[model samples]
Target: MYIPSPFRDDDLENMRATIRCARLANLITATSGGPLATPLPLLLDESEGEHGTLYGHLAKRNPQWRIATIGDAMAIFTGPEAYVTPSWYSSKRQAEHVVPTWNYIAVHAHGPIEFFDDPDRLLEIVTRLTNIHETSRATPWAVSDAPVDFIAAQLREIVGVRIPITRVESKRKMSQNRPMPDRIGVATGLAASKLARDQEVAPLILVQD
Candidate 1:
């Protein structure tokens, strides 16, 4: 991720928040054949390593794990984003110098990836994934809700993935490069948008650091 100085986000806590909030992520690996990517839900363990550890799984038949990887894997998590038009900038009215851009948050976690077939670890990953997404429900479901045999059968069809994050890169591009008036204009424009993501990005544009 090419992040300018103004947009660079070095805060580890903020990056963790983005990771936790992201509904899904793309796990990418470089293989001899090419690159293989899997979209999945991941659980982050902040206490695992210097950075963090990510847990997820892929279908047993998925070739990504069977094939040898060339280097460390990368997990990409994206947060709320919106399109910013030059029309939203007050400076554009005076000089028309501003162009359109995107305001968004992105995080990349890179580390060595290990794939395992251990049923115990697989069960743990899926159970935690389930609980995280189901906690808001009136009646949350659990892995114990299913018959042991059924879950055991299901677990056999997947391979567990673990990545102890070695490094991380992130950017929070919310018009921090813009002047106050231009940023306010961006906030007002985004706040007026009907898109939910745009609304979510509005306040971030004008955040004071």
Candidate 2:
């Protein structure tokens, strides 16, 4: 990820928050055939490594897991994002030099990826993933709710994924490069937007203030 100095975010805790809040991620690998990518939900274990570890699963038949990767895999987690029009910038009226841009938060985790077929590990991963997403519901479902045999059978059709993160890159482009007046304009404009994502991004734009 090419991040300008003003947009660069090196805070580890902030990166972790972004990862946890992201509903899904894009896992990319460079294979001998070509580049392959899969969109999946991955959980981060911050206590596991110097950086962190990622856990997820892929369908057994997904060729991405079977193919060998050329280098370390990358997991991309994107948080709230919104389109910013120049009309929202005060500079547009003063200098008429402002152009449209985007405001977003993204974290890229790179590490060696290992694929395993161990049933025990797969069960643990699935259980934790399920709980993370379901615990907020009134009737939270759990892996134990299903029959052992049924769960075991389902696990056979999937492959477990583990990535010991070697590095992380985070970027938060919330108009930090713009002046205060322009940023305030952007925040108010986004807060007025009907899009949920835009509304979510509105407060982030003001965090620097």
Candidate 3:
């Protein structure tokens, strides 16, 4: 990610929070054949390694897991994002110098990729992942909810992934480069947008008083 100093998010805790909030991540790997990417719901274990560890799984038949990856892989987590129009910039009329841009948050985690087929480890990862997403539900579900034979049969169709994070790059382009008035204008414009995603991203770029 090409993040300017003003848009760089170096706070480790904030970066981790963004990762946790992102329900899905894009896993990218460089292979001898070419580059392959898969979207997956990944779990971050912050206590595991220097940076952290990522856990997820792929379908057993997915060729991505069979390909060889060089060195490390990347997991991309994306947060709220919105389009900023030139009309929202105070500088637009100053000298016709303003152009459109985007505001968003993203985190990239780099780590050594490891794939496993151990049923026990697979069961553990699946259980933890299920719990993480289901905890907020009124009727929470668990992997153990199913019969043991059924669960084992399901696990046979998937392959587990573990990546020990070596580095994390976070970027938050939230109009920090704009002046106060311009930022405020952007927030106002976005807040009025009909799109729910725009409304969600608007407050993220609000200028501090």
Residue 105 of model 2, lDDT score = 93
Off by over 4 Å in 3: 207-209
> Tens-digit lDDT track for model 1 on 14-58?
999999999999999998889999999999988899898999999
Models sorted by lDDT, best on top: 2, 1, 3
lDDT accuracy of residue 50 in candidate 2: 91
> Can you tell me which runs of candidate 2 are displaced by over 4 Å?
none
The count of backbone overlaps in candidate 1 is: 0
Per-prediction TM-score: 0.98, 0.98, 0.96
> Which candidate number has the best lDDT?
2
- TM-score between candidate 3 and the true structure: 0.96
Tens digits of lDDT, candidate 3, 51-104? 779999999999988999987899999999999998998878787988899889
What do the candidate models score in CA lDDT, each in turn?
0.94, 0.95, 0.91
TM-score of 1: 0.98
Whole-model lDDT, model 2: 0.95
Candidate 3: give the clashing pairs: none
Per-residue alpha-carbon lDDT of candidate 2 for residues 55-144, written as tens digits (9 for 90 to 100): 999999999999999999999999999999999888788687778999999999999999999999999999999999999999999999
Pairs clashing within candidate 1: none
